[model samples]
Target chain A: MIPIILFLAPALAMALFIFRSKKLNAVVICLYSFTHLACSVTLLVHPASYGRYFQVEPLNLFFLVVLSVVLAGISVYNADFTLKSAVPARKSTYYSAAVLVFSAAISGVVLGANLGMMWVCLETTTITGAYLIYYKTGKEPLEAAWKYMFICSIGIAFAFVGLIFLSLAFTGSQPSLFFTDINAHAPVFNKFWLKMSFVFMAIGFGTKAGLAPVHTWLPDAYSEAPSPVSALLSAALLNSELLIIIRILKIMKIADLGGFASAFLITMGVLSVFVAAVYIIRVGNYKRMLAYSSIENMGLITISAAIGGPAAFAAVLHIAAHAFSKASLFMTSGNILKRYYTREINGVTGLLKADPKAGWSWIAGFILLCGIPPSPIFLSEFIMIRTMFGRGMWWLAVPVMLLVTIVIYGMASTMFKMSFGNPQKGISQERFNILNYAGQFVFIAVLCLLGIYMPKAISDLITAAASLM
Target chain B: MTEVLIAIFGITMLYVSSTSRVEAYIRVLAVQGVILFLMVLLDHAHLEVLNLVFLGAETLLFKAIIIPVFLMFTVRKNNIQREAEPFMPSFYSVLITTAIFAFGFLIAFWASSNASNVRPLYFGVSIATIITGLFIIISRKKIITHVMGYIMIENGIFMLAMSVVGEMPMIVNLGVLLDLFAAIYLLGLFVTKINSTFDELHIDSLTNLRD
Candidate 1:
């Protein structure tokens, strides 16, 4: 029943959109989002109702749940955002419908039992995401949308070729692309083809994951996109891309190619963080700053997850912590953008004095993002650092800590300057709307709660999900 | 017959590499599409009726007919100048493309040494075509030409997928076709949108959002 609703709801939304029943869209969005979250929570106990094409196992269970949670928050936020924004009626309807499609596609990417199905779902996310990125349709948005569309599509297309190469590793007439089956028989697959396949996919899926070398489209898309879309892309879409890469890396693990995959992963991971570190300081726009931070966090996740053991557990915690915090920050940045009409760091001033809720949320989000104490990111980073030492990876620890420090300092200095200054003349205080800050506050509260006291069940789930590596 | 179709398919990349005219590129894409449909049909002569229909729709209807027509419409509608205005000289592009093709054959020779279910010629040609498609993208300046490069890469990838005898599930095949269609369709839409928004349809105009 859950899977049915999950799959059918998008089509229903599209139908409604086509019929011009754009009213009640906010309620429709909220109802469908609850169904999505409920379905993910339900799948924690029961396997998916649709088992052939989509499956739910421990590896994907937590990812699915996090996606739903982040998306649910985004959905609530988007409902408020759409209702209040001065966007024309038809445009808002299209936005709502596109969001539904994007939701389904990301869900599909998480639940795909077959590798090919995952590839398809991953590409669909790009198409829908481009729409959201291009929502404003101005010069910057158009350019961002174009680059995002071209690069990611070409990346996924190469991934499809990689899929074919993976099939070539098998000698049979019909190669099974089932994820579990591939993982099981990975040892027997041809090493040459498997290595080739991984190279293509690393470049391919890495583009989506915001890894260095292929991460150029990310900052543009993130900054140009409406805040909610940025939230969704950072929180949900990236995790889905990482899920597939994690599965592929598992194949490498089973095939005795763990070192190769890990070396490749760490290189990209380090480079991503290094790149983000360099750019975060030099970048002028605050939203692009958030985008670079996402790249850095993704780098951190990949590095620790590659290291395995307790660090992998920490990585999962980091994924959740980063998702909600980044979502909060980006959306709050939207609030900041609306208040000031500028994304430039120097252009806007006195955020705290003007709108206290958004201002505080912005600072809290920055705190969580930079891994301050009492934020779950602090706990995750602590575990990663401990594992780095215990495993005799003291060399990796230096760069990791250094780049992390750079990132925090860069973001913190910008955040403080924006938060503390006096407002420019002609600034008017808009009516306080709880919806704008509601999702962000809730996420911050959850992260704080997790940091102070991690629940046993949630810990168990993260542990189990981490063990799949 | 299969080798001949594949040979003509590989040769199409040579023309695309050497040509600067957008109309010629569109025609060559159409030719490659027909050749792909023929090659796939020949490879899987004993396929089921359902599979045959899908292959025909994906390769013949969409790839050959619809996509070419759409590209043509975009070209005419945008009033784009005929020259693709590639970043490199045509002579250099032809040389590089040929070298890449030679490299592909060398790889095929090496890969054939292993025990695998691959058609060496088909595999080699498709790899070269894919590389050449990428080369076209990097060496070209026009956004429309970039879309052509994307379409070429798709064709090359499709051919590569078909080169091996292994069968992906029909559902995945459907997914691939649908995605390809949506991507190209969206590319067409954006080409028109970008064309109107900017003075020239060149990639240089797209540098506004860079960090």
Candidate 2:
């Protein structure tokens, strides 16, 4: 029942947009967000009651919570942001509808019990998100939207091929697409087909996860999109894609092919970090830099998952922490963009003087993202490094740490320069509504609070989700 | 009979690689769709009425009719140039595609010798088609050509899926069909948008957002 409502609320909101009332659009979006959050909480509390097709397991519960929190925050921010933006009414309605649809698609991805259903939901996100990226109605945004749609479509098409290969692994059996059934039957499956399937799935979903080699579209799409949409792309969409990859890893584990899969993940993970380091150091666009940072963090998560055991637990924690921190950072970047009217790093200075709240939030979010003290990413990175050393892979740890340090320095230098300098003379100093800052505040508060204290229930949930992987 | 049809399907990709015209690409796609429809009919004699109907609609209507016609509509609407302007010359593309086809045959022969459960010819042609499609995408400069290449890839995947026809659930088939239609629809729409936004439909113009 909850799952049904969760799926329907966004559809209802999208339908409401046809009436073209901006006020109603805001009302419906907020209503949908609160309802979604409520459903996530209820589902988290009683995950077993859901139907088989959309069951809320511990792993999905954590993702659902993260998504719901981010959605709630974004919705609040969007209400204020949309009101002030110069977009026409019709486009705003479309934007509002697309946002709802995007959220619903992500929720569907998290809640989907079958791989096929998850794939469908994931593709839906690409479509809806393409619209959001194209919201600015410019040549560049159009290119971003086109590349995003076309490349992701190709990537996902390959993933579908991967799914076909996966089915081929079930030779002479009652073929099933359900995750539980696949896991149960994995050991007896054809190893060659399974390996082939994993390769395709990795490339296919890896494109969406913004893994290196297939991550060409990520920076462009992120930089070109509206900030809130960027937040959703980095925070929720990437996590959902990773969730599929994690499920594949679980199947690999059951088939005694965990080592093989882990090797590939680690290779891609290291490559992603290396790629992020290369680009982050010289990136001209701040949003593109944030996009690169996302790639780096995703790489770390992949590396953590590859290390398995305690590192897997850290991977889950890092996912949650990164979501909040990155969302806040992206939202704050929105504030910066609003004030400065430019995405170029060189264009803005004295952020602290121009807008103290956004400036501080930017610094805080960057620090949190950089894995400074108490940030869950710091703990996650520590555990991952320990795992590497424990496994006698100190060689791998050295480059990873080096690359991470480079990325940190690159991001921090730019951030500090932007945050503390004298304001550029001609830029207008318009005050933003408090509501615009509300989401970032919530995200930062959560990130900071979690860094210092982990409530027992949240810790238990993270542990349970990790153990599943 | 199915083998001959599959071979023809594989040969279509060669023609596609050698050609530089957008209309030729669409024609190739339509021909492949028809061949696929025939292959399905010949291979799945035991399929239920509903399944047969679904396959017929998928192959004949959507793939052969709707997609090509819709693409042609987009092409006409945009008044796109006739020449595709490949990154590489036609001769090289043809030579490379031939080499790929030979490689596919080699793979098929090897897998047949190894007693693999997969039908070697199906695996070989599908893999070659997929590779050729990717090559087309990479070598082509125009967005429409890229889309055509993507369709080729979809056709290859469909061929592979046909190899294990009854084993997969119906829902997977439905999902695949949905994805295909949606992807094609969206790609076509974007082509029009790109036409209007940029002076030309060349993909090089899309480099504005890069770092």
Candidate 3:
């Protein structure tokens, strides 16, 4: 029942976006975010089901909380981000509406108990997200939106084929599309079709998760979108995609094909990390650099998920930790973009002199992303490597660690070049809004506190989520 | 009867690949939707009246009527160039699609040899159509043609779902159809905007965003 409000909140907001004056755009967005945060918290505290099609299980519970938290932060930032913009009022109005729909689609993806429902919501994200990317109405945004939507649509089509294959595995009276039903009966399913289904779904859902080879659109789309949207894309959208994969992985485990699923995920994970390591070095666009870092983080989480057990605990923690850390970085990047008016790494320097607050946030975001101590990423990477060694996956562990180190440098060099230099002459000296920093400040603080100490409730939630995986 | 309709559905992709005219692709989609409607009607004859009506509305009104109409409207409104300007020649495209069809046939025969539950023909044709749709998307230079390829893949998915012995709920089917409509409408809107922005549906002008 509470899940219905998550869906309804967006509808209400969309109504306000259409009927009300533009002034209410921020208020409507803020209201919806509050509604979103409220519903997810209630749902987590008191698990509820919306018929058989939507349920708040341990796995999605963790992802839902992460998404709501990220949305809450992005909403606050977006309210200010829209206040003064090069973007016209009409365009920003549509942008606000699209963001609402995008967040709702993601929540739908996370809440769906039925795989079909999840797939629908997943595709909805592609549509809404494409519009959000194209909000500025120009060449680059169009191209980015086109590539993102077209590629993801095809990926989604393949996933539907996978769903068909899943039905093929059931030879009896009726095939079920519900996740729990599939999980319950997977042991008796046909092995050949099960493997085939897994293959197609991995490629299908993996594409959306920005897993490598199929991840060609991630950099462009992430780099091209406005910073608030980028934060949502990096923090919320990708998690929903990975959550689907996690659900599929659980099904694979139930069928005693955990070995196959684990190998497949690890291979994809390393490829994603390697792609980041290769591409991040050559990127001149700071936003694209951040985009590559996102891919690498996603790869790390995937590897941890594949490793299972306590490593899966690390995976869940890293997902939450990375969500906050990355969102803050992207939001801070917005601040830098507004002042400098360029995305190129060489376009602006002396970020510290220009806006010390943003500059420090950027540095702090880099440190958190690089997995230094007091960042949960450090703990996750440590556990991931120790577990890989414990499992005698030396070959996998060593290369992933090396590639990740390279990725860290790729981001760090870009960060230092921008953060420490003199603020470029002739930069815009527009009055900076304190509200612009609201989201990033809260995100950084929460991330730092979590890194220092994990509350029992959150850790228990993480453990429960991991056990399901 | 359904098998015959399914085979015709697979053959439609061959036409899709062989043609240079984008309108023909849209026409083929309309034909495939009609084919799908017929197949669903024949298959679900015994379903409840409510389910039957909804399914009919889905494949007929939504799939057959709405999509192709909007697509044709988009093409005409944009005055898009009729030529698909595919990356490869039509000859190679035809050959590749044929090869894909043969492979699908082979897989259908091989996998279902021991299983009575397999509807080999539908499985083969749907798989073949899906791959061919993907081929069209990658090979074609026009964004409109790419959309046609997407719709083609969607038709293949509908056929694939129909092939299964047990049925997915009508609600899921309705959801897919609705989502497909939304996707097409948005894509069409973008295509129009893209046409105006770059002055054509050419993919070449979209090269600015690369790393």
Of the candidates shown, which would achieve the greatest lDDT relative to the real structure? 2
lDDT of 2 by residue, A148-202 (tens): 8888988998898788888888866877789989998999888878988899999
Give each model's whole-structure lDDT: 0.85, 0.87, 0.85
Give one digit per residue, the lDDT tens place, for model 3 in A39-65. Answer: 889888899888888888888999999
TM-score of each: 0.96, 0.97, 0.95
Query: Residues B165-192, candidate 2, lDDT per residue (tens digit)?
Result: 7676463375456667655767666877
Top candidate, metric TM-score? 2
Error of 2 at A35 (Å): 1.5
Sorted into a CAPRI-style docking class, model 2 comes out as medium
DockQ, structure candidate 1: 0.58
Chain A accuracy as TM-score for every candidate? 0.97, 0.98, 0.98
Best candidate, DockQ: 2
- lDDT per residue as tens, model 1, B1-211: 9898988988889989999999999999899889978876786754666776777678888788888898898888778899999888899999999999999998887777764666789889988988999999999999888988988888888778776533554533644475576557566668888878998899999988866
Q: For candidate 3, report its TM-score.
A: 0.95
Candidate 2, clashing residue pairs? A350-A421
The CA lDDT at A383 in model 1 is 95
**Better candidate number, 1 or 3, judged by TM-score:** 1
